[model samples]
Target: MINQDFLSRIRRKNNWTQEDMAKIIGVSRPTFIALEKGIGSPTLDQIKKLADKLGCESQDILSEDIVDEEKYREVLLETIRYGAATDGKITKTKLAKLIYLNDFAWYYQHLESMTGAKYRRLKLGPVPNIYFSKVEELINEGVLNLEIKKDGSQMISLSRAGQMLKPNLLKTEEKKLIKNISQKWQGKRTEEIVKFTHEQLPYKICRDGEVIPYELITQQDPEYVY
Candidate 1:
């Protein structure tokens, strides 16, 4: 059930009325009431918007599992390190799918995502909404670089390999999974991985642009995963 009290408290704390809450959530007043009364469940997108407005992680409103952003950044760096080509660059789209596979496949096994970040279905595949902005942030920090190719694809690479944090934030298990995913997808064409993720149950059942529920992966067959 959605935490009705949290919504009410946050709304009140901000001196906002029910109408204001509805506006922020992009829903009508009655629908907002239904959500508040536990008669309806909030969509992941709505939860994400509310969390953004309040300057908090989406899990803060939905669950106790907070998103570990630093660890997520580390995972991205490690994915690039393990999965990049000999020149140490990975296509932006491919990198997104690789991280999605790592996170969702881990969730399939452990009942939790590696980053606790929410992913939304997009034309290419399931990707966290923040993936682009986060990549941009890394580029700004001189931790990663981006190049636009003649084919219109964006390629990313580490600006300085040594700039990656020491005593990595990723746990052993997490790093292992990323390495395994990297090896398996190595040399695979971008089209092949795109087809693979597009066929997964979580992506298949969701509408275009919908947030994919992590629970759906539980129903996916083992071999079909990642």
Candidate 2:
């Protein structure tokens, strides 16, 4: 079941009013209130939409289950491997970009549900500074590394310590996560496979049974889970 308290916390973190969120998600103010208050459970479709809008995975909202420190380290190692495989090194900026981009795709899909309004068109923009702050925290903890150049663009990469831990990150866990996502979005305009790259995570939008990767599917507000 979805955690209403978790939803409330995320809402407050974003400084969004219930009405504001209701408008974005295409729900009535009263319905949104009911949802936040734990008076009802949202439909599967509604949950899917909500997951996207909040820039979080469904697992993040589903229960109080928390990933322990061991699991956290494992996932971070996998992320480093995936990121570095595309390039020799994983930078902080790259990590931030990947996390934010994925979140944006999730949120954009659920925008109408969150705001309770007609889904407006979204423009891909630069990542916000708050994301950088989160990235910095990770860097300070030795999870990632930042190489700043004179040109002002920093090459953010994962640390060597992070790289060594990748194999311990269970592939079975990742496969299950992707499988759940696929089932949740079955037969929708959304694609079955979401590929994350060094540059962007492609959100393939289907048109007439044909998959087309749209640039509009870029990430917006980014948060690092670990």
Candidate 3:
């Protein structure tokens, strides 16, 4: 079940029109429109072609219709922790890349749109506002720190509270979700899985190698307990 809304959301967040995306995927505009509308299903070959053009995993596109939000949030938090723990400080680009791998495009777009006053990109690039909002909220809650540099680059790292909260946040339910995701996608490339999942977790790698993030809409459903 390909999600029409998810497809539209991804297209809009990137500021890409249907026609623009169609051109990129080497498909006729009508064909692309059909895909988005869920009137037709793309073959595996078409999925691969689209993934290559989008620089994302096949799972991202495939899973759009059946995303489980609670599972997604746990994955996201874990990814953040992993990124933060890697070098004791999470750079915005690294966090962004991780988020991209998780296929949170709307959130990524929000980060791009809202990171205006707090941070700037090293290059002329879109900042992800949703990421910033989460970061900002976490910062206000004493879960993270936002370090702005004179050179316009930003550094984000977990706070003491964030560090403490990380392990506790991973309950048995989350662990199962993580295990399932890992088992399903193990040995597969992130981009490939992301594209295949395609519900809310679709991802696109920016030109600078940063993974553009998006929102996990399924997370918003209250019944979606991990």
Candidate 4:
């Protein structure tokens, strides 16, 4: 069920009238009223817009009862799966860079991260330690397999025993950006991708193991900015 009271409270707290909120969310005033009156459900995009307007996380705007850990896990696994599907195989470095790009791309456009993972400076680029841990957990549970090649290259492959991703887990915009990121970087050599990242403003400014803030995306050099 939708938390109409919470939505109404947040809207009111922002000092926005029904019309103002509706316009910001790109919905008709009557439709916004219907949503706040519990007569209609809000789609993921609407919820995201509301959260942005209200200056809160989408999960916070929707309901405080539901945690986002599972959502994060799903996104992490799906990103790897999508990267593998993009190239028939994906190296660990490439997969990490793809996820990094997706997050930055989404942030640049939406002013909010699609997956709120903290990225840190690494040899390749801004890599998320949380993603590494989550991947390890999935591997331990037989959801994915990691292979080490003779040349010391590592790759990730999906295991057949794992549950398939739910079709509606990601919003259309999110999926589109992920696919675009994968396709853009799929065939590039690991070193080339790393060089690209190194030239980007975020990776250049951050020290090793430091958290790379989303704000840094704005400092991108025009020559190679995303």
Which predicted model would earn the best lDDT?
1
Number of clashes recorded per candidate:
0, 28, 47, 0
List the lowest-lDDT window of 10 residues for candidate 3: 112-121
Identify the leading candidate in terms of TM-score.
1
- Candidate 2 per-residue C-alpha lDDT over 1-226 given as tens digits, one digit per residue, 9 for 90 to 100: 3443444555655678998777766789899888878788667666567678867876655632222224333433444445442344544434443433333343354321111111111122223334444456667888777777786656555677655544443346453442333333333221111223212333223222222232344342232111
Question: Model-by-model lDDT, in order?
Answer: 0.81, 0.45, 0.49, 0.71
Task: List where candidate 2 sits over 4 angstroms from the true fold.
Answer: 1-80, 85-87, 90-94, 107-124, 164-226
Per-residue lDDT, model 1, residue 210, is 88
- lDDT tens digits by residue: candidate 1, 141-217: 88898999999989999887424555366788989999999888877778888999999999999999888988899
TM-score (all chains, Cα) for each model? 0.72, 0.36, 0.36, 0.65
Residue 134 displacement (Å), model 2: 1.7
Instruction: Name the better of 2 and 4 by lDDT.
Output: 4
- When 2 and 3 are scored with TM-score, the better candidate is 3
Clashes, model 3 = 47
lDDT of 2 at 57: 72
